[model samples]
Structure formats: C-alpha cells, structure tokens
Target: MVTPTLALLHTSPVHVPVFEGLRDQDHPGFALRHLVHEDLLARARAEGPEAVADDIQELLVRTVAEGAGVVLCTCSTIGAVAEARAAAVGVPLVRVDRPMAAEAVAAGRSVAVVATLESTLGPTRVLVEEEAARAGRPVDVTTVLVEGAWERFEAGDREGHTRLIVDAVDALEGVDSVVLAQASMADAADRATLPVPVVSSPRPGLRAAVLRCAEGVKS
Candidate 1:
C-alpha cells in the first residue's frame, strides 16, 4: 500500500506474483505496486500494439502522478509504446524485455527469440535487432513461436505452458543465445540446460528500474 515507489504495469494478473517473488528474493525492502490492465493486451491482440498506445501512456502518467518513482512495463505487446513515452509519463519507465534483448544480442550474433504470443514475437524480435544496431553488431535473429503454448497459459495450465516452452527451447538447432520474449515463458527457458545462455526479462528489468530509482534518474 503506501503508494509503492515502484510500479509495474502488466497485462496478465499472473505477472503480479511472478514479479513480487522477484522483488522479495532480489530487492528486499523495495516498495512495489502492480497494476493489471487485461483489456489493454486483449485489445492489442485483437487489433495491434499501436491500438493501445494512448491507453498505456495515460495509465502510466497517472501512476507517476500517484507517486511511483519508477514504472516498469511488463507486457511485451505494448512495451515499445510504454518505453517510447516514458519521458512524457513523468517517470523512469523500464520495458522489461529490453534488457534481455540487449543481453541476447550481446551474447552472440545468432540470437533465438522465443515467444508464445503472436503479439509478443514481432516486437521482441525487433527489440533484439534494435539492440544489435545500437551495439553496432550484425545479428541473425531466429524467432521461435511455440504453438499452443498461449492456449495452455490462458487455460491456467502453467505446467503445460512451461513444458511446451521447455521442449521447444530444447529442440532449437542453432542459436548463440535464447531470449524468452515473454516474462511468462522465462521459467521454462531457465529449466533448460542449454549450451547457449538464456536471457529473460523480469530480473534484469527490475534491477535496472531499481537502479534508476536509487540514482534518482528520471526518464
């Protein structure tokens, strides 16, 4: 309560506990708040990510007005919009998958981007490429869309979702590193004992936001 200093905007309520657990384990004593906007992602999926730009911007600016020093957008479908408008939102807004994408591109030139949602895959792939461009590295990104995984997640079958994701990650033929596009798929990716490194968003993303909060850096 106390109007958390750090806030997370999420599309799925499931991410609340996932991030909370991370806060507890990694950033103890950090005040965190979670705001779920299921309809935003639903509309994005039905239409496209651009459809929810205004909604994301408005909601986040309001969150800053309420007292959150840092805002973390955890939905990949609309993450670009959130990050793009963070300065306008009046706070340091972190797009969760960006750090992971940057890390993936840094790990190697051959990057594998994996996602369960069609809405997520494209943006994540582009993000990795942009990171590569920023680093001036030539990257070959392979996008792996795990079939039927989102259905399992929507059905509240987390184990099934994780199982499918893990299996797909296992079968990846050639990639220097794997980037799990959705934070939801990260657990399964972590389960793999891959020769290549697997990067996921939540941990590095929150750490970056927390650092911004500590340094009093405003976006």
Candidate 2:
C-alpha cells in the first residue's frame, strides 16, 4: 500500500494545484490530504494570530494519526509554529520554506523575499534574518508584496495574478535573489523579470519528503 503523505495546504485555494503538481511527480505511491487554512486565517485576521498556533497543532496531530507517513505544511507564514508542531508530532513535518531558506542563505548575503500576503512576508523576513545570522553574513532583506495579486487569484484570474506578482517582484529595488514565499508563486520564478536567482519551496520540500518517505517505507 502507498504510504500517506499528508500535505496541510495553506488558506489559499490557489495552493491546491501546486500540491497537485508535487504529487504528479513520477515517484512511488503516496497520498496527499489537504487541510485548508482558510478558517484559521479568517479567524486570525478577524480575531488575532493568537489562536492559529493551537489550531495548527491540533490539525498536525490529526493528520499524522491518520496514517500519514509524514506531514508537510505548504504555508511559509507559520514556520515557527510548524516547527513546533513537527517536534510535537514526533514525525517528519516539513515546513515549506525551511529547505528553501537554507539554500538561499548558502547562496548569497543579500536575499529578497517576494510574497503577496502581509502575514507571510513577516515570517519569511524573520526566517531570512535568522538564516543569515547563523551564516555569519551581513544580510539585506527586502519584502515585496504583489499588490492585488491575491484578489485576482481568488477571482480565477491566473494570468492576471501572475503578471501582477511578477510586476511587483520586478519592482523590488535590490537584492541578491528572491525567494517565493508561497509555493503557488513558483511559476513567477520562471519569468524573466528576476535577474537574480529565484528559490522555490514546494519542489525542494517535495523532493526531500519524497526521499525520506521512500527511506521510511523501505525500512
């Protein structure tokens, strides 16, 4: 039987396809379960960020217990909480941006994080700062939120959203390279607007998880 590899997708419905893309890879058998963050996000936005951590912890435990060989959260915004949950779950819980952030820190001294959501940008900035600090490099971090991209994405305008995000990223004045804060934004990395390197989370995390899952199944 194929082991289940649960993917707790973020609040954005847009991430569904991105996770689908990850599963589409020609790896051995695996199953993905998407747990939307919409409700959590709505509550956090309406109420506050205080409650989402508990919600994530609860969801992480539930998903892992459902025979999930490993759990992965697709949102970069909740890295710290996700890390904590992963530790609590006592199973592999891959935070989407951890692998990518590690790569970015190794590549250069200055990093630019391109994200549309304000919530995501904050966590991503912290991750970059922490990574650079550990690397002992003088890091310059810049965050650019793609104006109106998320709204257009929800309206089912993929092309328009892509264009808007690419435009916003292009507008980021300076940096060594840019990291797409969300997996859904990976497509933007292919665009020619970014003269520097573009790092993406989904691919790296997917590859790592897939390899680890395969190892687990073998043992």
Candidate 3:
C-alpha cells in the first residue's frame, strides 16, 4: 500500500540529517533513513561500479521491506546502482537528480552541474541528459569537481565548505543555472550569489516525493 509519506533512503551519512531538515519545513510527512555506504563507496572506487551496485541492491531490498514509499538515494556516486535498485523494487525509487535535472532543464537551456566529488559527475551527466530528453529540450550540462570541499564538511568546517563551493562555482563563465549534486552542497547555495539559478536536491527531491505521495492519496 502506498503511504501518505515517503522515505528518503540515504546513501551518505550527511544526507540523513539534511533530509531531516527538509521534513522540518517543506515536508513534514517525509522521513529519512540511511544505509551505510562509506565502506561500500570505498570498495567501489577501488574495485568497479558493479561492486557498488551489488551492495546497493542489498540495502534497497532491506529498506523496501521496511515500508518505504519511495527510496531516494542521496549519493550520486552510486546512481547506476540506485537505478538498478529502483528496478528491482516494486515501489517508486528516486535518484536525487531526477528532480533537480528536470528543474535545471526548466530553468534554462544551459545548466552547470557543480559537485565537489569527482565520483558524482558521471551520474550527474546521465541525469541531465535524461531529464533533457524528457523535457524535449537540448541542454548544455557542464560538470565541475571542487576538491577539499567534501573534506571540510567531514571535518566540521562549515565556513570552509561554503567558501570552496562559492569559489568553484564562480569560475563557471556562462551557464543558465547550477545544480548541486549532493545534499551537503545545499548549504553552499545560500552563500552563492550568481547570475544564474541554483538548484539542489534536498528541496526539489523532497518536494517531488511529497507531491508524488499526495497525488497517490488523491487517486
């Protein structure tokens, strides 16, 4: 049965609380839970993408059984695995980009995908292309990876994290909009004052999932 709320199946530890913050405001009915991926992500980086997919599959199977309405994976590194897990489950599973990418396409014909993690770029590109196709619009998606930002966040340096993202995004010469790949990156958006629109997963993803649940209830 489809519940009135959706569960954010987090892939990274940082994403867990970020989504919780969203529920505090925009989505009170939504809940967030996570599966461990630090070790799993490390293994995938050392091994290959297939290895990551296998671990994600196990986590999704367990999370789905726990009565989750939708499984939204937070990390873009394992997006391919996230898609596979979605296919494996009978419920709606959402990747973080599905909404942001769509928003990017809607915002402008050119979109810049900004991420501090190199691992997230591949999936971000795939998501941009997919969303563009669905919108029947051609878009230019540029991916930029900023180093040390993620480390700063891990070390509890919020100011450092904010500075790094603003500086990196400032370098992008011309883009209609910017889409931040991870939930941690959302904090940087408030600090950035760019000529283009800034899109992040936490807001758009939660809004989409909540609306999906709402629509299901009305149906």
The candidate that achieves the highest lDDT relative to the unseen native structure = 1
Q: lDDT values of the candidates?
A: 0.88, 0.75, 0.76
The sequence of per-residue lDDT tens digits that candidate 1 reaches over residues 48-129 is 9888888888888889899888899999988987888777656578899888888898889999988999888899988999
TM-score of 2: 0.86
lDDT of 3: 0.76
User: Poorest 10 consecutive residues of model 3 by lDDT?
Assistant: 2-11
Error of 2 at 125 (Å): 0.9
For candidate 2, write residues 174-203 as lDDT tens digits: 577788887777878788376777888888
Model 2 stretches astray by more than 4 angstroms:
1-4, 26-28, 134-136, 215-219
Error of 3 at 27 (Å): 2.2
Per-model TM-score versus the true fold:
0.94, 0.86, 0.89
- Model 2 scores a C-alpha lDDT of 0.75
In TM-score terms, candidate 1 sits at: 0.94
Sort every candidate by lDDT, greatest first: 1, 3, 2
